[model samples]
Target chain A: MDILKEISENLELGDFEKVSLLTKKAIEEKIPVEKILKFGLIGGMDIVGEKYKTHQIFLPDVLMSARAMHAGMDVLKPFFIREGMPNSGKVILGTIQGDLHDIGKNLVGIMLKGAGFEVIDLGTDVSPEKFIETAKKEAAYIIGMSALLTTTMPMMRKVVELLKKEGLEDKVKTIIGGAPVSKDFAQSIGADAYGYDSTDAVESVRKLFNQA
Target chain B: MRPVLRFLEDELIERIVSEARDVLCKLGVEIHNKDVLSMLGEHGAKVNMDKYHVLFTNEIIDKALKTVPKSFKLYDVLGNQTHDFSGYDVYYTPGSAALNILDYDTNKIRRPETSDYIKFTKVVSGLKNIASQSTALIPADIHEKISDSYRLYLSLLFCEKPVVTGAFTIEAFEIMKELQIAVRGTEKELAQKPLTIFSCCPTSPVKWSDVTSQNLLDCSRFSIPVEFIAMPLSGFMAPVTLVGTLIQHTAETLSGVVISQLTNPGAPVLYGGSPAIFDLRFETTPMGAVETEMIDCAYNEIGKYLGMPTQAYISLSDSKQVDAQAGLESSMGATLAALSGINNIAGPGMLDFESCQSTEKLVLDNEICGMTLRMLKGIVPREDFPTLPRLEELLKEKHLLISEHTRKYLKEEFYFPSSVIDRANRTRWEKEGRVTLIKRAHAEVEKLTRDYAPSRLPEDIKKELTKLMMGEARRYDMKRLPEIEI
Candidate 1:
């Protein structure tokens, strides 16, 4: 039996310690790094993502499997970086400036991670300048912002303007969400898209990549 | 003609009561207040002072149960006896201490001020089915330390009906008593008339805090009727099963009864509860959930079995707004509690998980309470069992709309809805601008508040009441209290 097949089995089963040890064992066994990343870890996570979409698994189950996939990825990441980073695009997520609410943004981050996107969480009370700098430094393709207070919703527009000012508007798409964020507000702010909830945010991010 | 609603069989009642007694004797209850421990010890309870747990034997519990008066009258502002809270009779009031009011016109949720209390009381006074008053809104503008006293003061001034209100601190409790004394003339007369039923709650998981325990003692000493509300959140503070939760409720309520009796024999107390199932998903005690209604009905059954006057927090909705969910949950709870023969049904006009109040909901629940009362009245047997004469009359008429018997029985037998409920014909309804229940209720509320004229207090007593309240305010360095135009 292939060791990567066993790694996929353990990853799907959500056994993080076994996934980590098996990935190390596969590396020692002279398995190709791309096959381990694609056929083993990503393959397991793809099944989890489908299960999550179809309601076969819930948030807690998806979270556990994502954790297992991360265990395997930790062992294989150095090899992938040397091989020029064979992975999905990056997404920078945060609550907008002067807003201390990050629960929605954190949920979107987890779902994005489960769907194989590398997410950089900037946390709450995040300024627009910090979001643009991180997107440029990480070469991220998407910037997602959340604000639970209507008072702080205007900060999302500032981030979009900063992206345009830095000449990264064409390269990066912007998405906004939260209790107060609406489609009309998104349009008025000139955002690329608006998500009603975290699940909708995942679908919108996937659509953005599909268009690219 | 009112049909009694009973849920428990004799055998099951006996079983639950016996189990509760066994729990009290064996498991005991934790009382953090040393004075309560001493009081229970003096009354023959096996109190372990170091452990702060007192074990009540069957003899002690029976003695305490006997001391509580089975019936009492709650008085209105004019010193007239209002609802007789005894046996199967039930009264309705809005839930208290809501932090915000839903501005119906603006469709905005904001903190309620002293002005909102005036409006709330006026609406409560106008509604016929809302039998009592509660300081429903805890104004955000008042000083936090004196807010409870200020709420009672406002209730005494604006409300014509007796209030279902309480105190937070010992000073607030004394001040509330002073306010009641001002209305009743003397402390003895106030105790005899009982303008308010002070509510004291014991913290869940079988622990009594110092403040609530002291309140029990004060209520006993003052001879004021007290409502012992034991709220247990199932699966968290209490057992997850309904039967287990009931056992805990029985034990906690019985413990409070024992304390009240020991403080002063024949201290009037009402057995009441607002137990709810803990929602593990949201980590909230959803009071409007169906399981909560079931808990209420089941506990009231135990209360009636003990021959105790019972109160249940019902008719409260968990909806954040006055939407369909609010109507459904509120009506369901009101119906269930009333049908279960709860004596004092206290939860109406409350929304957003009991943290907010709305005037529209108050008027809406007035209709619900009327319907519930009618349902509790059941089918009447005015004549003999045969009904041959009525049958013949019905057959002869074919249409009983204008029959003499139909006209005679119309007001007595049926529940008549007021303007808040829409029952007009389609053509008339359309011609009337298709008025919604909310719109009618808003109009009713506006008219009620605008037309309200409070019972005038004597100048000297009014000044005395103001001076007493100001004395407390001065202690807190509050320069200005909310002015009252009434």
Candidate 2:
């Protein structure tokens, strides 16, 4: 990958061609995927994630970063498909039903990518049935959920219960996060993890993987 | 200092109280939900929940009013005396209420960098006319090297008067100590000159956060004065009537008084409230309207009646723009706050219904503060008339009253605007950039931010606070920060 393009894409500050060009450059140069993941994606996302936490950037920045991350990821998608393998872990994510906010969930997705995990972002307001079905089909190891509004935090509990009812709870790890979600709250809701931000979300997933 | 201003003398206060009283007794204030009604009834208030209205006899009102304390002190780390709200003028700002500008990197609004916060505070501090300044905006420019006490460091590095602020966590409070140490020169001194950090209770009838409660206790034990700021949305959260709102305010105040005095009686507690009806039409809380005047008059009376010093939110507004509406609201609010003898007023530099802060308004409001002081001076009587044998000499030469003494009186009594604001004739005013007050204000803010000199803090103390903030920032593994040009 063109180092500049990949770095800019991973940073979430640029657009599609920025990442495509960087990826194409790296591919032409025969640079390994592992090095591209660490130097470009990891480096870029580190900047974006910290900025989000400090009020220097807002939701629009998060969206832009996610788009860039995807642009870079798109080039790597085919290589992974050809190899028929996934790096790190497979995680499924969504904003619980009734909560339409996607900012926090999207950041978590970007951070997960930076952490070298494949994240299936189930766009917000996802129902219990959809979560169970996705977990089954993707056979994802980690279940990451986010909620921004207080009114929708309870869905975290409901989704967890529904997963148990479908007998998928033990089969997969469940984590919950959002503005309203607390560490104590996560325990009360019977979720395996609780994250307050993108960094916490990544850390929790890493811990989950370590324990497994 | 001028023996407390009377709300009755303030025309706006009178208008607001009478209008609110009529609205309550006639149309009545909305109780809205049954929960609020039930809560009031439990406190001996008569509630017509179906109509969403409440009525309280003087007896219930009195009982609630008795619960509040009149005066409170804010202490710095040295426990050096800074402000006493009961009978002094105190001015502060909002608690960074909205999640605006953030660090481009972390994207969290933890704190703005020390340099930025200092610049912001210096503008207010140098004004000197401002009584108290509480600005706890996070420093974003600082890299995520967490453990640094950004808020405390900046307040310590800049401000001179009492700073109204709060702690988000215990670690943050430790940093606050470092900030305090930096200002007062010694830990022992800051402990003695403990600051009057303001704690905000939930907006009406809501339980105080456990964290907030704990912080209050901690501040109390340290001899730091505490001010309980109860912000109730009249049409939304509290009573719809002026009197009912006072009762709600009374309950909130009384509970804090009990807690404050319970922990440290005469612990220098001040009673204050920032309540106004929510203008549902605009989806905003009108803080500087007649509604705000009523709030100041009634609640201040409750505090004064209890023989305790008081404070309230003045210099407020619900105008969405920094236009005539902004001027009207802020002017009226500042008048009410001063007239009612409030010890502290937060945020007068707001426009667009208090949604935005403008530097021009800051400069303009500084002028207004001077005007309000003149108004409080009240009508000058014959006592200062000088019997003017000198003026009489000039009168002897004139047909009527254009005497030199009269000229002197006119020149001395009338307050003049500074050159930045156009007070000149239209012909000349058109030449100076046609610059509106806001444009001038923006320029002023930029200048102040750049020219501000950081408060000289003791090196060790500054280092300690910085360490705490930077360390705390890092626990969350906060690394990079946004690049802010300003």
Query: Number of the top candidate by lDDT?
Result: 1
lDDT of 1 by residue, A111-167 (tens): 788667899999899999999989889989999999999899999999999888888
Q: TM-scores for chain B, in order? A: 0.94, 0.73
Docking class of 1: incorrect
Which parts of model 2 are misplaced by more than 4 Å?
Answer: A1-212, B1-82, B88-98, B101-116, B136-149, B185-188, B352-355, B381-385, B393-416, B479-486
Q: Give TM per candidate.
A: 0.67, 0.54
Cα deviation of B125, candidate 2, in Å: 2.8
- Using Cα atoms, each model's DockQ against the true complex is 0.00, 0.00
Worst 10 residues of 1 chain B by lDDT: B397-406
**Candidate 2 per-residue lDDT over residues B14-40, each given as its tens digit:** 444444334333443343445445655
Instruction: Report chain A TM-scores, every model.
Output: 0.86, 0.71
Tens digits of per-residue lDDT, candidate 1, B1-486, equal 666655667787788778888888998888888988988887788999999888888888889878777787888867899978787888898988898899997978899998898889888988888999987989888888889888888888777789888788876888889988988899899888888888889888777888889888898898888888899988999999888888888888888888888788888778898789999999988889998888888888888778778898889998988878989999999988887878888889998877889998898899999999888877877553687877787676433443446655666677766678886545346646999878988987887888887756666776777788888888899998887786
